[model samples]
Target chain A: MTDAASLSAPEAARRSLVGWLLVLSLPLLMAVMELSVYAVEPRVLSLRNIVNVLDQASYAFVFASAQMMVILTRGFDLSLGTSVSTVSVASALAMTGLVAAGAPDALVVAAGLIAGLGVGALVGLFNGGFVAGLGINPFVVTLGSLNICLGLSTTISGGGPVFNVPDVFSRLFYNGKLMPGVSIPIMIAVLIGLGLYFLLNHTTFGRSLYIIGNNPRAARVAGLPSRRYLMFAYLACSLLAAFGGLMLTARTGSGEPNLGGSLMLESIAAAVIGGVSLQGGVGGVGAVVFGALFVTMLSNSMDLLEVGGYVQQILLGCVIIIAIFLDRLRQTRA
Target chain B: MTHIVDRRGAGAVSQRALRGYARVGFLPTVLIVLVVAMALFVPRFLSVQNVFNVLRSSSYLVILSAGQMLVLIVGGFDLSVGAVVPLASVVSAMTMVWAGGAVPGQTGLIIALGVLAGLGSGLLVGLLNGLCVAFLKVSAFIVTLGSMSIATGMALLLTNGIPVYGMPKAFVSGFGRGLWFQLPTAVYLAALVVAAVWFIQNFTKMGRYLYAIGGNLHAATVSGVRTKTYLVLAYAVCSILAAVTGLALTAEIGSGQAVINGQLTLESIAAAVIAGVSLKGGVGRVEMVTLAALFLLILTNAMDLLRIDPRIQTIFLGLIVVLAVAIEEMGKRRTPVD
Candidate 1:
């Protein structure tokens, strides 16, 4: 691990400058989007729409952060979207089952939350056990787990939406606000971002992940518990995904088997666009926030422009490619 | 290489032969066991009609897996193949309809135009994927993932989320459902593709180059192999085969739908890997992949016969994929370097 203090003053300053630029790029892009959309449709610039974009971006923020953790350890979790679906379905079923059994609202919510998080943790264990413990490729393991989760979700939900949660659940979790104009989801996203930032930058486990991702051979030679750290990374990733799914379940007031439509790709797109390298050992919470915001704003702006869903999807695909291309260019130049 | 030569003694040779059999016969052995068990337990499992049904359904998978094997051999796997299927189907179907309407009776010309358009669309996507992955140095996974989204969007946009109907009756019947012998037309098509792929893998310089590239890319580059061009070719061929499967499937179903064959990409990869195609690349056999496809189809067919829940079947499929890969990993660990 190269510490910032070891670098010369100019080098440190230049690095910080680059970091600031990367962090600023998304807001800069969002500003440009605002200007362009204003020229086309001025109504989209209203505070209500801005808040709507932020609210939607909250989900992306959480999902992107989850993806970032695994990518930091040089792993890909293709199962994230399906895991979210499973969590949604599992938690929803648990809650609904509890509700039918005459459980109190708080107990129902707590059990549902625990069930969702538990499913997420189990998926993480499955993936981590294969990839970290058994030395299988993360791609194949996660792909297998994706299918398993999809199947499990559909089976548990009976291939339909699980509905009829207690009204109070959504009221306190998703709809409630900490202050005026600040929804619970937005607050949760912010808290998660801060927690992840602190953990990644200040903790031994987080620092060890970076080291392992940078050079697994070296990390192993240095006697770091690389496998355990990798396992925790995947666990954290899936837990965050489950948390996002729980928020979504609250908002929708249902457990949706198909809840994760296109989110797996979008989460990766968000992280990648936020300067998170797929090769790993780089990126941060700031990048993830900006990336999530940018993706949300782009979609929101396109929606305001009345672009069709299919066309928006096409544009998003293009965005992913272009982001990766630019990242490659940056890598080569650096 | 030296180990095999040094182990020329009678006992050593038999041991080596047994190990080789275990390596090469894993899929076939499982397939045989599955067939025997299904036949013994399931009613009508051994019926000729059921066997043909399995073969007919597996023909498309076999074709797709043949292409997937090539890409895997060349050190990349495509997630976009599934999207390419629907995109090709929609484009081809729409082209045939439009051309038929314009010409007012030229069936042959219309079919030609439709096939060309569908293949052209596939080629374009393949080119995009190849260019990005080979020239721009993007990860094949991300590139294909993006292309998958793009192709899917294009398919949906072209059809407005509706299935394209009105394909020529002759087009659907002659190529899609027509049987030369007792087998479905698709079975013949799949066989032809398998033969073509086998020829490419066994007899062509491109095949050897692909293996070399996959086995050790740096070594291949050092040895003057044109890695970039071959990589593009591999991807192009893979997508083109997927397009072929798409066209055939459209013919069979008599419509072009955006959502059709959504599972082909993963299933094809699964088939190839289960047949011993290494995800790490530079391995696999066409015959084995075909057998693996057949095995999967039979497994599904048998489960359906036994009235197993489709959801449980899906879970079984996932477990099989993971188990196959895990077994391969264990086998690799047990084997010493030659």
Candidate 2:
């Protein structure tokens, strides 16, 4: 809706300033939270606590990034949480089965990763094909897939956690560090975030995706391969989610059929709070990172303050509503 | 009658009937086939007890789907209905307990107060959702999603993550698990809701305005329709009916839990859509949606009878929804102009 070509230089400057302010608001919120927590207990603001919060935010960052890609192209993936669960179960099963057969550690890990990513890719392909090729509603398609994935995960795991994964797999992927005080999850999340930032800001595919989301008809008229781009968006989203699931498996040292509970909603919340437009064609990786961090920190601070989980849920709902209200104001002004 | 018969012959009359069936859509045909197949294959599938059991179990879903149909007709979604069910149950159960203790031996007063409290909770949620979607101009999905979370939180808070016990014995047995005229009491309640919704959808000015609004908001606004009021009314009615379902379920289950009927939100939407309710708005029927809900119930019931795994049953449900929507899409493409 904000046409770049039609805006005057001064108006554009003002709009960009507002956008920057919105992005900065996440960190600003984080600071406010820090102050409040410090007021309650200064010891909670230690450097160690900050690192722990970041560690907690690692999964949020990954899931939010994955969600941001699909949202950028004007699609929703309600199946992300279930898909992650499926992937976790699949990969864990593969590693455990291979290990039981006396396979080497490297082979077991490779097989697990491949099985997990492969399942993710298949789910993505199904979603993309229905939404892009058949033109079905994204919500319905993803909703259906969400159920299917949940069923598959539960069925394969027989309604329990899959265990006995190779220890080396977790060590190399989740626990190992290039240096002390830096976790593998944090590194993976950062690498994915930076990779997406570059891809979104510096590539023709990314620009075309923006144009397509902004106005699909115009993109088609201008000869953009909108279908392929949309398909790739869903595929990439599921793949990223799958990678995150693999990391979760490594962290927990097992395949949890219920892994990433409520993650679909949380990731969407993070992306939306970080300034990603649900209507699409607006947002950045930087905004989403801060958004994920802000959400993680809010929960962490609440835990420190001994807030009930129910209250946290209520506050989260309120925060999402407020964030969207602000987003509407920004849009109208722009 | 003779003249009509002479003019249209037998073939023409059958053709007209076939056309009417087409207009009603393929759901009925599918339902019939599924029913016949199950009756033939599954033992005891046609017994009176099993038939009544299916109807009893599907009553809640039927009511919820009728409510969902109202919202779909207005081009909106209410994901919060699932959360509202539990919230209503918890609030009502808690109220009943407190009131019963306050007024010892006043069973009637306690039940009435509980029902009122339950409906009030639903109304509050509905009002918030409707106001946000109508006045604030927020997307219905996001507003309902937020309310869903809020409502779930409220339910959990009220019950402290535990089920509320101590419901009046008479209330639970006479209403929740009662039989009336050889059918479950819930069936009568479900029928009353269906009839009420059907009447509103067909014979009310507000319903017509809602249809006009959903069909084309700009045109309806130009034609002097109060689009906002009708939209809110639709959402409110939807939530109230969901609340009714919650009350019935609470009585049946004999407790108020935080997570009762979590799947109803998705299931209700699926039933409406599968019954040929247009998500794009301005189209749906109460009878068809009720029938669709029954069909879904029967499908699950049959699967259970066949000793199928519950997980596989979930997969079947998901596949059926997608397949139905895909078929509808193909049908639309074939008829391009419409």
Candidate 3:
């Protein structure tokens, strides 16, 4: 990598080919899928349809971008989905009460973010505590918390959606225009993606993630704050997951305990299909943005083609498998 | 690491205490406290009927966890077991309806066929999982996750999200209604299974190989272990055991639910960990898993007596898993590995 500046022309071209193959394959495939769908329904390629795809991808974009970084550290957060559910329910309760009591709109929205992200952070704290400090497997720790969050969310909502939220909550948070035509959720997603890209590329904590991810012993030897960084990674994951959940709630104008049932898998699929190495230390946020977009686009295309939901699920599973299989091939060769 | 084990008890009584902590964890202590607390505080907690109820409902969990422990011991995770339970149960229930179908004379053969069909589905899953993981060298986590979704999709499609009803009267009566020694037949069957798994794990060469592989895969391979074959065999056995449990539970319910036991995979993983099974694999005992199953049932039973909602019980289960593993891990950290 340090010798890249001295590379010959043919070698540079080969490197470019490899880079495109790794980063652009999934998005190109998604484009092809969309083009095929466009053949059947030309409306699918319209400007309105493009925005809808972006909107649909936003919530998951938040989740996947966070998840990709955690995976880069060779850890997972199965509880992210359930944590999202829990926080959404908690935020809904806070928001609804505030609105009913005639609170100002600013206070209501502020309360929602605080309550939502608070619950997320607390869950992340315990998860990271046991996983990092006690040396327990992250999978087991997070898996247990996942169900805990699920139970709490359902119990709080009495196994239903919590409604009667202030119209302003959804109106401004989800559907409000950031620009003349851009949705708030899309803006948030883009900003978060860019924020993560800068963080991973420029920050000390972010560099620690790549180092600790690549080799834990080496990171320890280098005196990087590996454990602290791991804790922060999980914290960031849950925090972002809650933000996504809040967006989803605002989009529907209600808090749903059952929201994002498939989110853990979906987040993982997006990150993995985006060419993120599950072994840790090899991925970027830009690629993950494309990955999340590809997933949403694929789903939209399938819907346009009128595929059965069950078969689509089977296809989704196949894609995860194939994505990892390609990753293994790259791993062996690299 | 080997040196510490060799000098384990030689003037190392203090070190032995940490090892003891790793072995026992907080499970036995927590179980005793829970039992005492429930017995004193929770109403009707120790009633004979309630005891039976707890035992009956958790039979499936115990059986599933035992199978899962085997896979974990061999360095794999079988997330598909959650899907396998419903798929196995539904397929067999439908088979019973088609084959036995209130047929008096041919009930026995059809019932046998139905059980085989259920086991067959699990076996096929085991084979596919084993091939992709052991042969193709895909990580067990990703492979099982893929299988989890695929099997779940297939199950939902097969049953159309509805349960398979009308199990044979004779089968239900035999499995559920009739009690041997004042307990459901499922209890006795679960006991028989525990014994069988104990035998296989403690007495078989495959069991030894599984531990070897999990402890260090590269070293095991270098030492002439057939890691791939045993990996597949272990997964096959694990899936088959899960199938057996599913069959019994389906019969007990008198029908097969398409979404029955959605939490089985997580619950199984949790139970094994609470029972002192290392999530990294290579350590655990069948008896410990059995006890953990009972501990889980008692905890839930106590909570039920307090009129706790089902969802709250879910929280308690998760907390127990994390707390129990945390206790064990803290002990491990106190002891230096090398």
Candidate 1 lDDT, B141-238, residue by residue in tens = 77888899899999999999899999899889888877777778999899999998889889999989999988998899999999999999989998
lDDT of 2 by residue, B1-338 (tens): 24435766788698557556667877888999999999898768998999988999899999999988898888888989999999999999999999989998999999999999999999998988888878887767778888899999999998898999988998899999989888999999999999988888789998788788878888998999988888888899999998999999999999987898567899999899888888878888999999999999999999988999999998889889888888877866664242
True contacts kept of 2: 0.51
Off by over 4 Å in 3: A1-25, A38-43, B1-22, B40-43, B101-104, B335-338
Taking all chains together, the TM-score of candidate 2 against the true structure is 0.94
Ranking by TM-score: 1, 2, 3
Note the chain A TM-score of all models in turn.
Answer: 0.93, 0.94, 0.93
Error of 1 at B19 (Å): 2.0
Best by TM-score: 1
If you superpose only chain B onto the true chain B, what TM-score does each candidate give?
A: 0.95, 0.94, 0.91
lDDT of 1 by residue, A1-334 (tens): 4333245877556655566554355576678888999999997889999889889999999999999999988887889998999999999999999999999988999999899999999999999889889888787788788889988999999999999966877886799756887988888898998899899989999888888887889999999999899999999999999999999999999999999867888898899888787777877898798889888988899999999999988888887787777666555443
After superposing all C-alphas onto the true structure, candidate 1 shows an RMSD in angstroms of 2.4
Q: Which residue pairs in candidate 2 have backbone atoms (N, alpha carbon, C) closer than 3 angstroms, thus clashing?
A: none
Classified by CAPRI criteria, candidate 2 counts as medium
DockQ of 2: 0.63
Q: Write model 3 residue lDDT over B1-95, tens digit each, in one string.
A: 45556785656766776577655666777789989998888669888889788888788888989989988987788888888888788889888
Provide TM-scores for the models: 0.95, 0.94, 0.92
